[model samples]
Target: MPLSSAPISAPIARQGDGADPYAWLQARDEAEVLDYLKAENAWQEQQLADQAGLRETLFQEIKARILETDLSLPSPWGPYLYYTRTTAGDEYPRHYRCPRPVDGSHEADEAREQLLLDPNELADGGFLSLGAFSISPDHQRLAYSLDTSGEEVYRLFVKDLDSGQIHSLPFEDCDGSMTWANDSQTLFFAELDDTHRPYKLYRHRLGEEAAHEVFCEPDGRFFLSCLRSSSERQLILQLGSKTTGEVWVLDAEQPQQPFTCLAPRVEGHEYDVDHGLLEGVWTWFIRSNQDGINFALYHAPQTDHSVPTRADWQPLVAHSDTVMLDGVTFNARAITLSLREGGLPVIEVRPQGLPAYRVQLPDAAYSLYVQDSLEFDSDRIRLRYQSLNRPAQVRQLLLDSGEQRVLKQTPVLGEFDADAYVSQRLWATAADGTQVPISLVMRRDRQGLPAPLYLYGYGAYGASLDPWFSHARLSLLDRGVAFAIAHVRGGGELGEAWYRAGKQEHKHNTFDDFIACAEHLIAQGVTRAEQLVISGGSAGGLLIGAVLNQRPELFKAAIAEVPFVDVLNTMLDPDLPLTVTEYDEWGNPQEPEVHARIKGYAPYENVRAQAYPATLVIAGYNDSRVQYWEAAKWVAKLRTHKTDDNLLLLKTELDAGHGGMSGRYQGLRDVALEYGFVFKVLGLAL
Candidate 1:
């Protein structure tokens, strides 16, 4: 089936000022919108119908690299060793546990296995996602939340582990988060309002007929969440927005008491608290941005339950303009601080009264994350480390002895070798003379040739895109392609100042930085204009759309997934989900200046008569973040105005949300589809 050559008709203009021509597409369930999406789906399928064999080969290549049957490292919690395992054909993992031995051995006893939950059995034939899974303090009961739809609203369920019976709680519109009390009978959860914002906290007893609403946030800008402290002595409730937040604490031993505020929320002041013992004193470690753009660590005594102001905060670690304080975790013997400096993550461990030291890593460009510690009193801490060319390795570090051991290194099946690949960190100078970081990885055999290059970027909301391993990307590298990541300014790679320079009035820096990186790669002879392809998703999708409009002749192809291209219209509507809360990230368009700024760059508003490279745009019908209409409207406008007939395709997943299709095998198939499209455009062999 050939795609229709007749261009889509121009959208019908509305009577209001700045009215969108394609605003009618926003009616998701309307017949016309559904018809248009179905047509696009059919066209995409027809265009790639000849590559069915290649898609299958790519899928199998990715599947072969993963271990079908695997077990995660068991972490000791209470009297049991808890872990999850996946079977060969199952779509979800099964949660299991065994009694912890007195000898302190970290081995699972197969004969003593106890099954807590099996999602494969629960899901039946429909979509199922397991949300909050937590065990009671006594370890006799379990509370979990499940969402059968991809919309993210979940229902609560409790199970008696000893009796092997499950009871459904009479709660609706839950946000899928639960924190258990020390009594083992009470649980706290957050419930979403009509707009799908978590606005209320409720407490429920195991056998109660109705749950009690503990607190409700009156302010629409702030969202609520609940969690248990690491020490297991306090229940913490948090209310926060993009730039500010407040924390409240309740004594776990006294469930009847109301939560006390730790500190009142101040506009533009953000802080998070974790309880820990410092020098034998109960202390609160708060990571706050009150004194610096990049946060600082402050400590306060927990004895007086009164709210402490900024004046009472005593600095534990002063803020550094070069480093962004990410978070802090605690154990009885030490405190672990997660920080980002020079676009790389580093972990520092400080013993109760000793000096601090950083965790050692082999690669300059790699990603690191702290795993949950099972016990508060234990000295062992777990960390996950991975690089562009290396598989993930989970390590256990002892704070007392400074000893580290690798618990597991994810296996990459078949003849895979890390030595055959080369990964490097390169710098590109932006137009304003600021240095932008780029992480590149490629097969050693393709270094000198002018091969195809895949550049990826996302520079919004201070989110950092760190270097990590991807098994599916190997298919491209093996096909003589070089992959690179441009750590642009809107990201937190270079700290808060970097993010500030790329957002709001200075948003053009993001597009400028990306263009600079692409030119740098070409100047270095890594790839020429016709051999380059760029990709990004969500906000990054906005980046791809903006850059494509700015420099259409600079790349061969582009991919934008769930792109937020209709920014001006989205920000103008206050009734949309998450619109009010996102005013801090993207300026409020109700103001004339902000509206003009957004209109100047919004992809849907900027389409013109120009030739564009081959492009693939993806969307989900159920995506709440970026609506499906945004992509559909943008594609319609492009067809009407684009000067050249470059292959333009749109693929919409009917049953999925923001993230594509669910399940491991299904996700692999989606990647195969994307890789197949890229291969077809690049003229690569199957």
Candidate 2:
């Protein structure tokens, strides 16, 4: 009985409907759970078309055991220019003939006719051409951002990858990510206004007729902005959230001024601007709230008036419990430091302040990144390893004597063996005693009979899910299934008290730490509860719909990708657009006591019928952030209050959005149809 002390089943919990604190979890609220999810959305879309025909017959028997096993899905971008999909006299039988990054020279087949074009001619001219480009230093011009749907918004175009001509962008809620300036003719991005919120920060000067506001984000608070630079008229901002922040500098030719903080609004601080020299010497990174006496690399030195002067700073590396920094490549006489320290990832260097030569990394979850440098003198170094049966290896090294030089290798499955599968990481405990962390992976030959498991988690925004290594999760651990991952709770890996014990009013401690990491792998013997299943996508699909509505007898199947189970009508809609920046990570559900603690985990208003398991949800009709009709009305009211014969699949996709697939063999055929519904609900046989 040690697996997180299990024991909550009083009809899925109860006891406090007042003294407020989430009515101490008495349950049933929010306009009677949005009127029982609007009266079971049309009988769960008619039993989700027979659970999508048993997930397309377990994805054509795992694509016929991955086409009778030869297992070669590589792709880390090495073996320059290689892609093959032909059937002899191919008269267009599912065509695939890509080939371009060659250098076996003789002018490498005319540099593959000037770098292989055709992304369907930029999607037949309506735009999507990011097919060829590279400029961003001080050259000014090179941009691309498309996704016409997934909830419709991202559009930015701009291209001059040396006069090719495009220049789109007409203004719309850009929603996060974009950076380039050092005279790359300005570009920085972030948009939201029209009351969808997140104040603008635009810029577009290749011809410009419109594109202003260099910063706004305020209305009712929420800012997680990001942008970086060191030249082209200075810039380096980070804004806040995820527990306080603030560190400005902006100046792109002073666009209305007011943004010179350089680290102040602190509150459980967190900074990082890394490289330096817009006005001179810089290299940031802080963590403080005090504990491990952080600062794993700092340097400042700009002075005069841009802030940052702790006597012109300089710390450069400190560790305890582990550093793990990874980034900060500078070099005029040394500064390398990639980090990860004691679990692998090396490359120390330092110089001028001493400390040198480290290197390591034969593989322990690897990565290097410093690509190219000469005048500033750093000399190559991209690396990027992969294990759990190797798949992505990307090379470049050279760094004085690491010598490797591959380039790209992602076959995306040509055959599959991945060292016959095997991985581990363990550390369970959950149900209050805390400690969770799993990892798993499978098929190293084990008769753990009911072998199907799947498990996964996201908890909430603090995002942690680490222990990287995958070839599309070795095509589901080469079939016999297994996968794991948990690390539960408002992640941040055991830091800020495991993300304040899992967010807002301690969000049911992230669904009781993902059911005590799936009953600690069915009590450590490995897999059981009818061979579990569980899965997560988007807030880990609202942590697998809050553990299938508070544990429906453990599991036998589930997946919720793109899930947020209409959490109390999406935090009581603040005119939806990332719902008022997720009211400080899920809370303000129009307050009647945070709408009675978000309708006690609104998995489409908690469907009942007792024994409900077999599921599959997917969604993405251009997901405007979890809204494929809230996983199509929670698989239409869990197939109208499911009781037994459970099975409620739903696919949707409808031309992707919210990252469903954008190349790479259509996201491995939608992750081999969600691992063929976790090997046909644990019956396993692919």
Q: How high is the CA lDDT of each candidate model?
A: 0.88, 0.58
Candidate 1, which segments miss by more than 4 Å at Cα? Answer: 1-18, 304-309
Which one is best on lDDT?
A: 1
Tell me the TM-score of model 1: 0.96
| Cα-based lDDT at residue 448, candidate 2 | 59
Per-residue C-alpha lDDT of model 1 across residues 1-686, encoded as one tens digit per residue: 12242325323222222456667778778776776677777777778888899999999999999998999999898899999998887888899999997899879987998999999899886677789999999999989999876678899999999999999998899999988999999999999887678999999887789989999997777899998888898889999998899999988887778999888999999998888788888888789998898999999877755656567789998999888898888998998889998889989999887878999989989999898665999988899989999999999998866678989999999989997899999999999999999999999988887889999999998998989899999999999989999999999888899898889898889999999999999999999999999999998999999999999999999999999988888888877777787788889999999999988988888988999988999998888778888898888778777898788888888887788766778889989998998899999876
Q: 1-686 in candidate 2: lDDT tens per residue? A: 01111222101112234332122211223443333333332233443333466555544434443322121221212223222232322211121112333543211232342222234444542322131132355433446565444444566666653456676767666763556655566666777665445456666555666767766757444564555442234566666665565667765555345566666664655555544431234444343332342235655655445666444445556644545554556544555666544333456654543446765555444334454433343344455555544555566555545457666554443556655666666777876686776767787885456576778788777555655666556556656667777777686554444666788888888888889888878988788888888888887888788788888788888888778887887677676556766777777877788788878777767777778788877766556677666776566556656778766666666566666755544555577666655665666554
Task: Report the C-alpha displacement of residue 473, candidate 2, in angstroms.
Answer: 10
List ranges where model 2 is wrong by over 4 Å. Answer: 1-239, 248-271, 274-301, 304-384, 388-417, 421-479, 482-532, 536-541, 546-555, 558-584, 591-601, 614-686
